[model samples]
Target: MFDSRHIRTFHAVVASGSYSAAARLLGYTQPAITQQMKALERAAGTPLFTRLGRRMQLTEAGESLARHAETILGTLSAAESQLKAYARLRTGRVRLCGFPSANATLVPEALSALAAEHPGVQVELLEGEPPASLRRLERGECDITLAFTYPGLHEEVPDEVVEVRLLEDQLTVLLPTGHALARRRAVHLADLAEERWIAGCPRCRANLLHECAGLGFVPDIRFATDDNLVVQSLVAQGLGVAMMPALVLPSLSLTRVCGRTLEPAARRHISAYVRRDHLRIPATAVVLDMLRQVAANRVGC
Candidate 1:
């Protein structure tokens, strides 16, 4: 059996690139670090490192062991963090990731509540689109991810992730205040067939194209941007019309823009997701609860 201490020592050596540096970092003498490395090699029954002049390089076995060691150490660290969080609920860290609109609106409110409730808990926020955020969550880089899926569109969450639906956000059409369509209660996708459109997000743009195709008209997209503010600005300047989520309106200026719900009532389902196995972590649970509460309050649920 390989001792964790020896493995850790080996990891340190690999990280620092030499036994002497590893010893200094691990609080041991160089000779002791050498002894541990030799013991580790013996346990594996193969040479783990090769000396090239003054530098140490990992052999094939060492490279393999290093990869496994990283995974093992990472899992062990996560377990320790979860255990500590369980023991002391108020004093742990939670990593959260979300898209731009949620980061501007929902995340701020939820994090504010979390901070007020548990001052000792450290919260880290990463901004990303739904797909990237979900990927990060799967990679264990984040504890929770705020994601959305267009209800009737081509979007699906992975089965390994547990999604808790927070609210349904309506997709609204944004037109210049002086535009003819601004007088209508709602605009049909076909009615704006000739109008130049500003599109954002690849999946969202695809959804727009799909919906337009259903109406037998391909929208003439004149501008494309991922930035919601820019999309709103272009629409405000009468450059083009745009489809935006209701959640995004709260963050936009909307001074020269009029927003109306889509005629067919397109909606996106916003939800928070966590790995099934990570749901047991206290910090994750706390943040998830806070997120749900904030979402409910925002949607008046």
Candidate 2:
């Protein structure tokens, strides 16, 4: 195979019109230029240059290689420019997968900030719970994922992926306006042990059970749903009480419903997860930074 460096040197010598001139242009000694030309000719299996008086002229083989060199070098130069643009965040794409609440809250804000700072970097968003989002990431369907987990309640994160804690989202107790516990400054899990319960996504349901079990009673969960509005509506009708993350509370209208922090402070940790190798991707890294910036500052980069 022809070495690109040797081809480059061939062009320099042809363009500069002499071995000594090519050496000076290329920052190499005259002897180095001669050696490179010799190697290039051997690879081509024919002589490339001949002297015509004081001038160097291209032989037939030299003319053929030179004709293709322009296309070759142009392609190489264009590729390098694109790589530079990607590294500088001037152009790139990031696929972001997030759950429902985060899509409503952190994901939008972070994405807005990212677009403002990097207009050329495009982003695609997918909404799903942690398990689905993480699975997509593992399958190379996404570049970054926004997910949350209850401490010690969920399975361990995959070894190939790394988690960045964006914020600690406190779980708030949702109750109907007329519910007896709605007036309390804070509600204890034990206080509502016997009330009918509403559960959310799988992880949240697991957390509720884990905490309730610790309090020595099982909840009579009457409803299950992944939608926040559904959970809120159920609580508003006084059908059940539910626990939700603090991040989602503000966007939801509390009409006929109210929220209180758990007495001992149960929290679902919000995080951005990416494969370890993705940390080197500028677009992904930038998105992670923006998420941490817009989050509650409960944690840092």
Candidate 3:
């Protein structure tokens, strides 16, 4: 257990060739420099200096410690510099996890802005739906997670995390461009009772079943996929109808499908989940703020 302060003092003494000279350079009295040297020798479990004529010289152990001191100090100094830079948001890594829609919409905008503002801060992104991303957040696999819950469902967050509601993502029904309800301003869930359905992720599928059950029928789901493109393609081919968040619709080139807002106005609450301890991290804080701003400026959610 060598003290860094003691190691530094020893290095100074070795550099200056005498305790008195080292003390002068370090702005300490000679006695203080001598005491630090003694402490360093005690930590090393060997005598470091021996009197040679009128001057003190390094013993074998002292020479060994001197040989390694500069490298040790260099590593220590670099570590300190990196920590300071991280504290100032000058350099860091922020890991983010998000669902498909939010990743396609909010995340790209927020991350793009973050890159322009903090280029030294590296970012890693993972795509996972609500409970999955939330699990990653709790386990420390990710620093921040963007997750959402439907109108009829709520996600149970871990006690160690804090959830921040960002926006309301309106659920819209996607219909084939030539379908009878395509041109309608809005469509009722019950109106699609006879149509085959394309389900999304597990949570989205569950939300679909929940909303339909409330309207007195179960969706005849024939295709289950989480890819938004697949959902859009199925609807465009007149194969099935699916509910998608309005926020992601703009990002997709939707020439063959018409997305209408649900007649009952269903919406999901999109939120940012972060471990309580991570809120203090500068890069994570910056990323979280950017997400808020991007969500705030968006048309829906």
Candidate 4:
């Protein structure tokens, strides 16, 4: 019988395309990966890989074995998830990641609810922008991620990821207390065509440009930063105006800055994403449930 560890290493090597890459993914040295592959070939009674220069190519037997290995590993993973569920979620860890605004807003309430309900479950949190958070989720570094996409600007979620929409986050124009547009019930993008702008991250700035182009004007962005608080501070000091999502607006002081809805209503769709298999994990499911509830309550929906 072959050891599962050897088979797992073989699978990693095939997936990663090189021993060094597999070692990095599996937290093993290159020599260790080489040894495991050798052992696996011996157990199978056939050579599994052929070397073409520096590249490793799987043999016919290796291809057959790889298919079986995937089935075996997938079954094992499902079995482990089932066992954890049978244990009533008394112990297990769920790693969650999210963008900055979601981390500050809905995530806190969801985490609080999770802790109160599942006292025995451990939680880990990571903060990043939407793209980075999604990358972590794909790499298995996070079980779930809170991510957002501007409806007209960002592409749809990838087919491999399972996403659950939480809420629609509306964008608001933030102006200095003494600015001419500060008291408007809603501000049109064209109204601020001549004002200097404070922009957010690259994705946000791109979206701003797209929206402004629709209004027949391009903003003169004088400042750029990913930090929402810094953007607010700049606006507060009368440096420039900015557009921010509703979720991040709560973090800004209203004394020096005021937010008004956009006339055409720019918005983003906020969602939680996970690998399809991760949805079977009880802890992940619980956290997703709590997040949905928090979003519903916040939006009064």
Candidate 5:
């Protein structure tokens, strides 16, 4: 029989893609992780990975074993969570994931409150984009993920996952104080077609174009940035206009930029997602309630 620890180490290595990375993530030394993989290979009677330069790739047999390992690990996690359910907030770690904007505005405050109310409960924060956060949640890396949904993107709630809407965030047009539209109370999407735009990313650019096409014309993008703070700073420097969610408005450091709510009330709705398998745990329920309460209080929704 194969040891469960070996199976777990093998899964972590496959998920992380390197022995060193897996070791770091699992809090084990490089040699220990290597030995576990070797033991796993011996138990399975086949090699699991092939080293390619500095990286490692799983073999066909390894991939098949990985699938089974993932299922076994997931089942074990579910079992442990079930056992811990009775403890409620008395103990357990809550892994939370979200983008920087959410981190800036609500995440810290909410986490503080959670810590204060449940001192025995440990909290972990992970920052990333919506797609990445969702992937972490799916991978069991995070217990919960606060993710954003644009206007056209449908809210996808699979049977395995549950999404609770936190807030309906309005989009605001950000412009420098000296810009022509900065003095306006509101701006139409069509009015900015000729103006230079600062996009969030390539995906953001595509999404922006798709949204603006609804208003009759595409934007003239002059810059692209992954950092919203930099985008705001540049807009304050008279760079270009950017549309962003109001939930992140309070975190903007640029005082020279004005945020005007757009017409038709374009918005991104934020949601907290959890694995359906773990939702029944009491600690998970309490944390979810706290998140919902925090959002309702912060946004006054």
Candidate 6:
């Protein structure tokens, strides 16, 4: 059986025109190249090369072998490329869950990139809050879900779930344009006690209250909504202030509400949560890598 190594050595020596040059290209010693050639000639039952004044000249047998080597190598390379393409186009369905805030940018961009690369792969997206998304994943209703941990109120994800941290979305204060705290460089939890707060949802509000209590005061909750857009719109109307993660910044669509980094620097760590047992799937692995890369690029990491 003619091995790939033997064929490769033959191709390299013919292309480089000398054993020393071919050895340099292949990272093999000159003696090793000579040995490979001798082995190949022995297998072929003929002299492949003639020694002429320290240089190598191809015999008729060598010329014939070289032509066959070229075709064989080309065929092998094509086969490898086709295998890679098949893997890239692996047909499967991946169910993904995420919040609307993330859907604004990172989630959608990563999905678009994945779709472009793997057209045969089918992806189903479900939009919901983090806790709901996590539940869906835990129940095996979805393959992966986007999750986040707010300051002082970390949700305990199950040990059976593997979480891949995508990015640290720094928490920012969303205040109206004319608000007193908005004029300053940044606001701390202690600085905004007098103002009313716009909460995201009941769970999000509960999390906010817990985070605020850690800072020593409960914010007066004037309104609450799961919609970040609505929360920003309320803030713009001078209804109340809110905090949002950096993932929500790019597609906020509200010019009146300004996003400023909070003092004492809080951040929500966004991650991809998947069942540990199902990670062997290549479709999920490649998509997860793409999400991490996109998130890192956005945060200057």
Candidate number with greatest lDDT: 3
How far off is residue 237 in model 4, in Å?
A: 0.4
Across 196-261, the per-residue lDDT of candidate 1 in tens digits comes to 999988877888998898889999999888788899889989999998898887777878997877
Local accuracy of candidate 4 as per-residue lDDT tens digits, 1-301 = 8998898899899999999999999999999999889888888999999999999999999999988999999988899886866468766788989888888889889989878888877879898887888888888898999988887645455677898989998999989989988878999888889999999888889899999999899999999998888888999999999999988877776579988899898888888998888788788888899999999986721
Against the reference, the lDDT scores of all candidates come to 0.86, 0.87, 0.90, 0.87, 0.82, 0.83
Estimate, for each residue in 192-254, the C-alpha lDDT of model 5 and write its tens digit: 888889998554666788878888888888888878888898898887899877877777786
Candidate 4 error regions (>4 Å): 1-86, 153-158
For candidate 3, give the lDDT: 0.90
Error of 6 at 22 (Å): 45
Clashing pairs in 6: 200-225
Clashing pairs for model 5 are none
Error of 2 at 49 (Å): 2.7
> How many backbone clashes does every candidate have?
0, 0, 0, 0, 0, 1
Cα deviation of 124 in candidate 1 (Å)?
1.2
TM-score of each: 0.69, 0.87, 0.94, 0.70, 0.68, 0.67
Candidate 6: how many backbone clashes?
1
RMSD of each: 12.0, 2.7, 1.7, 15.1, 16.8, 10.5
Which whole-number lDDT from 0 to 100 does residue 272 have in model 3? 96
- Name the better of 1 and 6 by lDDT: 1
**What is candidate 5's CA lDDT for residue 141?**
92
Q: Per-residue CA lDDT of candidate 3, range 229-272, in tens?
A: 98898888889999989997887677988888897789889999
Clashing pairs in 4: none
Best by TM-score: 3
lDDT of 2 by residue, 62-142 (tens): 999999988888888899999999999999999999999989888888878888998888888888897888888888999
Which order, best to worst by TM-score? Answer: 3, 2, 4, 1, 5, 6
Query: What are the runs in model 6 whose C-alpha is more than 4 Å off?
Result: 1-86, 151-159
Q: lDDT value for candidate 1? A: 0.86
- Give the worst 10-residue stretch by lDDT in candidate 3: 150-159
